[model samples]
Target: MAQTTELTIGYFTVIFDEHTGWTGGLLVLNRGGRPVEFQCTLPVRPSRAHEILFGTTLRDHLIGEVIGPILIKKCRTPLSMVCCDQAESLSLSASGGVPVALVGEAAENDEGPITNDMLVGASRVKLAGATLHVPIEHTETVEGIAGRFVDLVDAVEPFERIREAIKEAQSQISRAS
Candidate 1:
């Protein structure tokens, strides 16, 4: 029998406000860049203790340890991979949940070959002028990410949907006040 692969990808990002604190959202997309599932967290205001205790690791702590896990836990669908806007989210791979990676905008004409892929670290996958930093253990994910975006436009397109949804939610919250 011929094998078939179905890719259910996810994009996760967190936005922070000085007054409202941090909010996170996760959007899962099918092979065609259509939304499958989405999960968003309530605005989380870390106490002063959290700021002082977490110290230098505060951003990583809130993202990877606090908010990211909450959103990922709410997802019922199993994700093939999650592309994140923050590199701190790469630590989500340690949760032993779905594979997670950070997608960054590549510099202009940055078409050089990906290096350090063979090493046990982040493997860079260039797609549509964006660089996806896949975790070392999930090196096999490169094939799926590449194949999925071949027919689709860009891998980072799902992030737009997630951010827009969050903005709409924020507007609704303010209106209720």
Candidate 2:
């Protein structure tokens, strides 16, 4: 499998505003970082009752359990792995039916040097100088897929494109309204 080349990666993120609620976007990119497909959801905001009910778990529930899976399901392209910027979105790995990685800043407060095992529970991986944490069971799969693209593209750069696309989508939505 390592000898096989080329893989598609799905970058997913959700943007929220008081008025817009939650807007989710998924950008599917080829090994070269060119977009193959893009999907975004209509904004969904929790009601005041829902906000209170969910409490501290609201964001995770909305972004991970709800928005994340919806975007993944709506994507047409088969993704080798899905990468998300928010840790809450990591929950997608549990039911996304594909490997999911949470990309973010490094944890600097660890008691000692960070080893793959320490991070592996979260299926953490380093690619293009970014740290990504995946589901423990999918660690090997995410790593293998990421390995193919590390040399061909900066794994973290496509995320910028995803963000830009999300902003563009938000503006379009606003204009439409």
Candidate 3:
């Protein structure tokens, strides 16, 4: 399929540091992979009680329930679809919001049942030369949303930028204190 529509794509991720808690960054890109908007959350350090209560689900709750939603809300541009690199953030797609996917290497998307909206897992989708583990039924949506631009985006690159930005922010905060 060819990309006929002018589309905007969003790459969102949450990074964690044991010393500073968690920080999230969302980068929205146009069809040309240019930045349209970027937003980040301050470090969210939970109490020991929260850690005990959430346990294994702590990461998911923080990234998916807290940080991911706020980052999405802060975006000014209307994103045609969202891409993430981690499993914890996958819960963001369940909101019935714009299409959200966990983008990974093509080799990672093993052939299997595609997880539906009601389910808690993901379905692997091959897009461009990469693998997109999308929530619900976003495989085709991404194929069309990306179109020619899909070839232009090395989806993992934006995440590196976001991570660097967040780390710099943390350093800045430490220096200011």
Highest lDDT: give the candidate number. Answer: 2
What are the lDDT figures for the candidates, one per model?
0.74, 0.75, 0.74
* Structural similarity to truth (TM-score) of each candidate: 0.83, 0.82, 0.82
Considering summed lDDT, which 10 consecutive residues are worst modelled in model 1? 106-115
Across residues 101-164, which tens digit of lDDT does each residue of candidate 2 receive? 8775532222454455544467467776787877778888878887777554566666667668
Candidate 3 positional error at 98, Å: 0.9
User: lDDT per residue, candidate 3, 1-177, as tens digits?
Assistant: 122335777788887788988889998877677777889999899999999999888877998899999998877777788887666666777773788877764111113432344235556665555777766466677667756575455766888889888888888989999
Q: Write the number of the candidate with greater lDDT, choosing between 1 and 2.
A: 2
Model 1: per-residue Cα lDDT over 82-138, one tens digit each: 888776787888894678877765211123433343224777776545777787677
Residue ranges of candidate 3 with Cα displaced over 4 Å: 1-6, 106-121
Lowest-scoring 10 consecutive residues by lDDT in candidate 2?
106-115
Q: What is the lDDT of residue 31 in candidate 3?
A: 69
Q: What is the lDDT of candidate 1?
A: 0.74
What RMSD, rounded to one decimal, does every model reach? 6.1, 5.4, 5.8
